[model samples]
Target: MSRRDAEDLEAAPDLIAEGARVLSGADIEGARFEAKIILAHILATKPSRVVINADPLAPDSISRFRELVSKRASRVPLQYVIGTHDFMGLMLACRPGVFVPRPETEVLVETVLGSLRPGRDRPTVADVGCGSGAIAVAIAHHLPGAAVHAVDISADAVRLTAENARRLGLAQSVRVYEGHLLDPLLAAGVADELDAIVANLPYIPSGEIDGLAPEISKHEPREALDGGPDGLMYFRKLVSQIEALPPRRRLVALEVGLGQARQVARLLQSGLECSAIEMRRDHGGIERIVLGFIDSQSH
Candidate 1:
């Protein structure tokens, strides 16, 4: 066969067809896209370019492509191999064991940004359990005057978050620390000074961690997934800490497990009066974010 014929056989459509043969499951469509993305990255091109060129994959490229596809077939996340994910228009670094920043959490960042106005600025903000520094860096990048601090329990997570902040040129604006939810911030003397606290803490019930997608259950850290028996452990602790805060600090934004929105709202209302509650929906319309603000006078 001529080289042109080989190229025709290795075109985008042909590659996708080959991918379909290897991936058979409820998520086959996602698998196909993943395969294309990996192939495009390996070829140093865009997804659109892959469809246009359709050049035959070199023998070396084919072997590497198949290796990635096999992992995708087993539900391994593509972002880990690519080492980056797009969140709120930011290219965030991701790796094995570090929680991949999800699109749903972008709503939380939007809500936090919306709360801050041009002239009225909060002096400090704390991002609890800030995986990859998505929330903290976004906040610092957007609100130049506000002081941003992030804390995570896992040392690796803290390191990854710090790396991301530096990559995004937010290392000077945002501070990343290693400690439990509020420990690091409190130790640094910024706890009570925080005007807003945002957290995307682990909210998956311990029993259900095994049931999550392999991309998450197997690759991501368990400490970032398990949220205790009912998946409210982190929320409970967060609310407790909020109540402990001084009167000057009040607003808090949290990302909860799907279907746990109401329960999380109730937990917040138990201690602080909710002046406003906005539920930010994911692409599927599920409530993915829960924002609450305490009345200034009450606190």
Candidate 2:
């Protein structure tokens, strides 16, 4: 078969099958299923609807679809290839190098939404290390009265988060800044007024990063995944930062890796960072979410 032969398949089923065959080499877990998803993206419809239509695709459309498949076959992430990821019901733009938000983190968002209590009519939230502003925008979208500040160290992350905020009509509610953790908020003169700091910082131990799927280890940003030698590097810094800051009812919510929740919980409770800590499990039954409330005066 010619290199371009698969692109010439006119019938939808034949075209999708050929695309699936191509995907099996590198991106294969379920190539046919993914092929249908690619079709859904091209048609701007649901995957289930891809086959029901079964309409003959135009040559240009087929070529475009196959090109996307080829990118996926090269082991590019599906979300990156599609250039969007559905997070908390919002389709946020995605790109190479920027870490993709996981669905499991939605439970972390829910944990924050249910637990955030600042005793004020309006609240301030800082989504530290906000990659694409997933948590920040979702919180601002749900809490129209909130002011969410999304801060990240990476310029690409900051730009992508800002773009997602603007696309979701949350530019006013969700502000994006390029800096590490809460420093941007402090510089913006609102650090002292913050009610919550939520983060899903890198927690994969250095030794384990290369062991992750190629889709993650090879394609995603390493700084967004590496957590130093022990995977507690960034978390420890964040806890210390909060502890050193002036005290208030500043809530902290974090997403932890498997088997690391207990140690992180201990880290939070060991100091003045968190007065009381709580853990919540994700759909995968992993202890994935942790939250803590800061005692106003350590009473």
Candidate 3:
């Protein structure tokens, strides 16, 4: 082994302590926690075990752990560094190009699931802009009878969604497609037959994107974050598209930014011909989800 690697292995505790100090200096919250997580990732063990064992690392593991700590210290998101995230009680694989699923978005999934009638068999649903397939896979996992079609504009997102579905054993139930919102569903011949449509589309205003944390503004995909000047660009387009399509009985659930729920609810009511609309809040009391329903026979 190289001289530096040999030295690092011998002083593993000192090395971990130093890594945590560096992260703390960079203002990274939970610096020690992140340090252990990075070390455990390299050691192929749990973070809890890492703390309890106090074992020295191998030369290679020390070197790799140092590299990851440095990356995290630079404000790289921990999820991206670890290459995974948890959403709706499901572990999802994440990558740089795809948007990481946030905890608030889970409310959107729950809203959609709650709207489903109990004991319904094989209800058809569509997920628009299905980044990382978090919502799509979670819906299919929780509602085994759901036939879910997930579509995304980015090929990377499409592939990631498919991968998550396959890993979660939802491949048979969730189909991932590459295209703009709703287009893939139309092509797949399920546009008019859908019982529900859910989307967590880009809702951050273009002007406000620059103010987001570096982990988001610099690392997350812009196409997944920018919602135009007023933060409703994609929502407006989606509502217009639904307006032009033939009417059908469908429940629509969308995740909107804070203070955007009322505006989005209005748009859905007028454009989608929804007869009833409801707003659901996240644990933070922020209105995060809007649900609209249209009767099967109503225009």
Worst 10 residues of 2 by lDDT: 3-12
lDDT of candidate 1 vs native?
0.80
Full-model lDDT, candidate 3: 0.87
For each candidate in turn, the TM-score is 0.88, 0.92, 0.93
Better of 2 and 3 by TM-score: 3
In candidate 1, what are the lDDT values of residues 170-284, reduced to their tens digit? 8888898899889887788889778888999999999999987777888889998999999999999988877877776357889988899999988887776667776777777
Model 1: CA > 4 A from native: 1-14, 25-27, 52-57
lDDT digits (tens) for residues 1-299 of candidate 2: 45355445444447678888999867489998998889889888888888743576666767788899999988889999889999999999999979999988899888888786335446898899899889998898877789998989999999999999999999999888898777777778888778888999999999999888889999999989999999999999988778766778778899999899999999888865567889999998999987878877741
- The positional error of residue 13 in candidate 2, measured at the CA in angstroms, is 5.3
The global C-alpha lDDT for each of the candidates, from Candidate 1 onward, is 0.80, 0.85, 0.87
How many residue pairs collide in each prediction? 0, 0, 0
Stretches of candidate 3 exceeding 4 Å from the true structure: 1-8, 14-16
Best by lDDT: 3
True-structure RMSD, every candidate? 3.3, 3.3, 2.1
Error of 1 at 41 (Å): 1.5
Say which prediction, candidate 1 or candidate 2, comes out ahead on TM-score.
2
Q: Report the error of model 2 at residue 279, Å.
A: 0.4
User: What lDDT is reached at residue 147 by model 3?
Assistant: 94
